[model samples]
Target: MVFTLEQHDSSKYRRKARMISIAMAGQLVIFGMLFSMLLTSTFGNSLWFYALGIVLGLLATSALFAVLRERPWMAEMRYVWQLRQHLSQISGFLPTLRGAVEEDNRAALDIVTFYHAGVAQLATLNGRTPPEDAAWLAEAKYLAEKREALGLPARVERFDSQDLQAFKRS
Candidate 1:
């Protein structure tokens, strides 16, 4: 049973965050260079003054970036933003699948099956699912085993709360 839509890998989000950070760093470097140049021009031939200005600007910018990256809120915002993008892509399918599960529609069942199979493949690729995904893994494993035993292709079934709980208990 797939509980969530296919999300871009966490690595993708991390890379995006890193890219944003790099862009910000570039902006900081540009600001620092501009500030240093302005100070050098204002001081008019004082080498010490220009050197101090450059050092101060670099230090200030580094401190600012350190704070930005270390802030809990910044990290949370990045993660949330990435998740939102992922969900938006598949959000509509969720309700449709859920409704089908509720109504026992065959088409919906097929969709759900396909979705889980995709998720299972991802999980396998990732080496293991996250802790929150334990239940889904269990269900997938069970269905796969059952299908193999029966010599039939496996179909993903909707996992209700009861089904998840039963899987966990075993």
Candidate 2:
């Protein structure tokens, strides 16, 4: 099976992005107010002190937003980015798995198991389906059954966040 980059719905992405930006702005404002209060308690309430709090708050918020943008839980954008990266690489690995399954190659079955589990895990996390998911599942199931028929263990390990992280590192 061939894999291709699919066009995502821009309207949905834009709506989510706007919501995240608003949340970040609200956090910044709250942080600034808290900082101002802290400054007021520590030192006398002065214009310069309040101004310094706002400046410091803005700097802190900027740094936090930069880091949060890359976090998977922040607005699902990072999840989509990671999913795209995985999908791009899958095309290259999939053909080998397909051949391995067809040839009943035991060594390659490990690769097939890992790839299938990883894709399944990513799809669940992203809340969306990859284009070839159905075909991939069918092939994976066939491979599992073939393994069983040959008196081999058919249990494929489920992939999780840690596995994904490890895969990314490699």
Candidate 3:
């Protein structure tokens, strides 16, 4: 199944991307100010002090970026950004992917597999159904089996609240 770009809301993804960009910029500015102030107070108005302040400000910004990169929301933002990028190039990528699939290209198949996984993950996060959930699942299963056949240990896990309740009952 061909997944068109229109199925997902690009506006929402664009907003999330903007929010993350703004947040990162705000963090960098705040950290830079704090570091500059601390450095200025420690060493009066010397040239060396100014150089150290700049260095420290950069380090502070890097630290904040490192910390934020580990956050779940940041990860979600990254995924949204990736989805947006792919959607923008879908017109070209989709046809190439289809051609590759027809030619049995492993790399293309891998890309498709991960694309479906990402779509499913995005849908679940937004509490919506993917445009082709069943097709995605079928493709996922096929890829898992294919990987296993090639001596790769691939497993797919499905979670159901009712299944957990049944286990608890026993």
Candidate 4:
């Protein structure tokens, strides 16, 4: 089966985020275990030692939770969802493109625009169009090029999906 560029890009990104999250979880567990052992090792020496361990553990756990919430990996996962939604929109619109309906043509352009916007957002997160994103990027480019060749005006822009939280957009 042939995969579209958008699917290729988004799936690679989702896979990368999944790998990182798994690695981070593993590291957290290892660190917690090691720190617990070190903290409890001096249990008989002083009560303050145990107290320090509690404080340190609490601080570490809190920090870990905060990181997991705000890290780029979390954002990447959210992007994966958005990308999938955009893909579905495109797929749904594709069948109508051959018809002589203005509305359908507009709908198709809108779907392509959303797909490109997703690409831009993913690019911002990665600081570059990721190599994995190349496929989708190429597809978007090819489609846009085709639209241009047909004398159609197409414009696309990217915005942070998280910003739409005001209307519960996420």
How many residue pairs collide in each prediction? Answer: 0, 0, 0, 3
Cα lDDT, all candidates? 0.54, 0.64, 0.57, 0.55
Per-model C-alpha RMSD: 12.9, 10.6, 13.2, 10.9
Tens-digit lDDT string for candidate 1 (1-170): 23333344556545656786787777667766777788878877677766776676778778777677767646633444433443343334655554644565444444545556555444443456633467766755654564566565576433332232322322
Candidate 2 vs 3: which has more TM-score = 2
Error of 3 at 45 (Å): 1.2
For candidate 3, the C-alpha RMSD (Å) to the true structure equals 13.2
User: Pick by lDDT: which candidate is best?
Assistant: 2
Please provide, for model 3 over 1-170, each residue's C-alpha lDDT reduced to its tens digit, 9 standing for 90 to 100: 22222244555655666787787677766666676677778876666676676677778777777777778756556555555455444333655654665566555555555556556656655666676667656767777766566665453222222222222322
Write the residue-wise lDDT of candidate 2 on 27-121 in tens digits. Answer: 88988888888998899889988888888789889988888786655545654565556545654656665675677766556556656655655
Model 2 clash pairs are none
Best by TM-score: 2
Off by over 4 Å in 3: 1-8, 80-170
Superposed model 4: Cα runs more than 4 Å off:
1-73, 98-104, 116-153, 158-170
Q: Ten-residue segment with the worst summed lDDT in candidate 2?
A: 158-167
Better of 2 and 3 by lDDT: 2
Instruction: List runs of model 2 lying over 4 Å from the truth.
Output: 1-88, 129-134, 158-170
TM-score of 2: 0.41
lDDT score for residue 58 of model 2 = 92
Worst 10 residues of 4 by lDDT: 161-170
